[model samples]
Target: MDAIILQVLNGLDKGGAYALIALGLTLVFGTLGVVNFAHGALFMLGAFCAVTFKKIITLEQIVLSKTELSPWGTPLEIRTPYAQQWFGDFGNVLIEYSVPFSLLLAIPVMLFIGIAMERGIIKHFYKRPHAEQILVTFGLAIVLQEIVKAFFGANPNPQPIPQIFMGAADLGVMVGMAENVITYPKWRLVYLFFSLGVIAAVFAFLRFTTFGLVVRAGMSDRETVSMLGINIDKRFTIMFGIAAVVAGLAGVMYTPILPPDYTLGMDFLVLSFIVVVVGGMGSLPGAVLAGFMLGVVQSLASMTEVKDIIPGIDQIIIYLIAVIILLVRPRGLLGKRGVMEN
Candidate 1:
């Protein structure tokens, strides 16, 4: 029973990432029909945004301590983050909350990246073959990877979460089970809520607002929307930016879960593409749904008893499910008719 609960929680955590990335992919593909191979690179950039902010916050001044000396009789030097020295309590708070505060840096950086990619590169390929689009964007991904590596080095950098979220939550007590019977990390739970909040905000923006209505209308019929005098191209470009923000923020929040590395974006890129495919091309809800479902499936496959029966099941479970779904549903669980169709 405990094992089941644990796996489910783990699934939700993993699903949050999958769903967020795939959701961004859906936005671009569903509306613009552009297969963005560089989306994962956007995610990687976002994680590095967090790293950059962390470095900025932790920038320190070294001073000789009058009362302290090293074992070799040299004056001890002290290092303190700028935020800590500038704001005192607030500075400490900023340092403690650096991970979440990175949003300020990530949003603008990712927005610029998305817009530049679209206007400068992607728009030109809108009418080109998918093979050409793939080649160009794949090249862009490599370029982004090298740029990051050149600046940040090839080492993995770990980001710290707030002190308040450092420990596990007692889910067993909350659910009326014995205390400690079903404990889970607080940050993971926080991450799940954060992911859900972002997803909800995206849906709300698209469903309730006038801009969203226009975007939806354009998705249904681009020529019709253009005929009605709406600049569908500009809106599509903005949507691409929004997608970049989504991928970026997901990476920002996920830094503590997985350390930031130059290859992080590429790592998640393949899985997210598989997710987008399995969810059906150009299906928003399908992408979101498959993200969570695959996450749960992957988690369950990692269990001891399950693995005992099927060696290496956990690692291959996601790919296996992808194959089965492709064979059975083809368009995915909630994908619309005629999308990627015969």
Candidate 2:
């Protein structure tokens, strides 16, 4: 029973990431009818944003002291981080929580990148074939990957979780089991809750806000909304930005769990696309639901008993489920009729 609970938690952690990326993919496709193969690159960029913020805050100033000498007779040097000198205790706190703080940097940066990409490149491909769209965006993703490699190298750079969130929590105690029977990382729990909150906020925004109302209408019938003089194009562009932000924030929060490398986005891209397909081509709710569902199944498949029964089951569980879901439900679990029918 404890093992089951642990696996469920693990699934939720993985699902949070899948859901966020898939949600963004669905949003862009649903809103603009554009297949953005480069969406995962935005996730990579968000992780890098955390890396960048940490690097910037920890920038050190070195001073050589003529009067002091080392045991080897070399001049002594004093090195102090600029953030510490500038902001003192507050800077230390910022450095300690750099991953969370990076969200502020990621929001504006990702928003600009998303909008610019849509306006400069994607806009030109609105009427282009899906093949061309996939080709161009995949090429863009490769370019972004190469750029990151050039700047940060090919090695994975791990981000530290906040000091306050470090260590594991004994969840077993909460469920009346023996302590330490179901230990899980505190950060993973934090991430699960954070993902849930973001998902809720997104749903609320779309459900309650006028901007979202217009966007939903545009998604339903673009021509009619345009005929109403609603500037549907502009609204769709903003939705693209919001989608980017969602992906970026997911990346930012994920850095602590997965040390990010230049190829990080590419690694996740295929699986997330699979998630989108299984969820449905453009169904937001389906994306979230399928993400968690697959996550749990994948986690459970990795268990010793399951693995012993079916060798390598964990490796192929998600793909197997995707195939099964596609076979069973052509339009996916919650996909609306007529969507992506063409």
Candidate 3:
């Protein structure tokens, strides 16, 4: 029972990430009517932001003082692989100092990349067919992934958890468990709560704010909204930007859990699409619910007993459930009656 509960908790954390990514994907598809195959790449870009930030902050030169010991206790001086591989001697300087500090410089730069993608590439595809959009976006995704590889290499680089979150918290006492039991990493807990808060804020924004109202209206009928003197196109662009930021932030925090790599986006992209479909196309609330549910199911499917009963259960459970759901509720749990009627 305790193990089950623990798995449930873990699943919730995974679900949170899926929910965020799927939310963004659904938003773009539901509102813009564009099948954004490059969405996964945007998520990857977000993780890269953290990597970039860490790299930037650690880029300072380490000049050993005449009479002082280095942080390593000796007159320590060594070149980092980054310098040796790329800049030659420059990367060595950064290893001597903090890397996470680079985040201050990495975020805005990433946001600019997001905007540039929207304006330079995605902007022209608004009126194209779904197949064309998907093909082009998929190509764009490949291009982006390759570019990242060109700069950072194809390796899954580790991004260390912040110093403040270096250890696990004792959740046993809080949850009435035995000693030496029920512990979780502080960084993961923080990320879980942070994700929840962001999800709530997004929902609140869409539910209560005028901008959200406009966005929602635009989603339902851009032509009608445009008739009312609102610039739906610009708003759509902003929405795209918002979606990028959401995916990016998801990627950012996720880096500590799963190392950031150019290929990491591919790992989540297919599952995110499944999540969106299971959640019901265009239903944000459904996406959140389905994400967490599938997360649990996927986690449970990994159990020894379950896997023994059904080999490869971990790989098939989510899709199997999705198939059942589709058979039962073709439109999805919370999908509108005529969402795809138009």
TM per candidate: 0.98, 0.97, 0.87
- lDDT for position 238 in model 1: 97
Error of model 3, residue 49, in angstroms: 0.7
Query: Compared with the true structure, what per-residue lDDT tens digits does model 1 show for residues 225-315?
Result: 9999999999999999999999999999999999989999898998988899889888888888889888888999999999999999999
Candidate achieving higher lDDT, 2 or 3: 2
Model 1 alpha-carbon miss at residue 88, Å: 2.4
Pairs that clash in candidate 3: 53-102, 53-103, 57-102, 58-94, 80-92
Q: What's the residue-level lDDT of 293 in candidate 2?
A: 84
The numbered model that scores best in TM-score is 1
Error of 1 at 234 (Å): 0.4
lDDT of 3 by residue, 108-161 (tens): 655676668778987888888778988988899889899999999989878877
The lDDT of model 2 is: 0.91
TM-score of 3: 0.87
Candidate 2, residue 291: how far the Cα is off, in Å? 1.1
Clashes of 2: 0
Model 2: runs farther than 4 Å from truth? Answer: 65-75
Candidate 2: Cα lDDT at 32 = 91
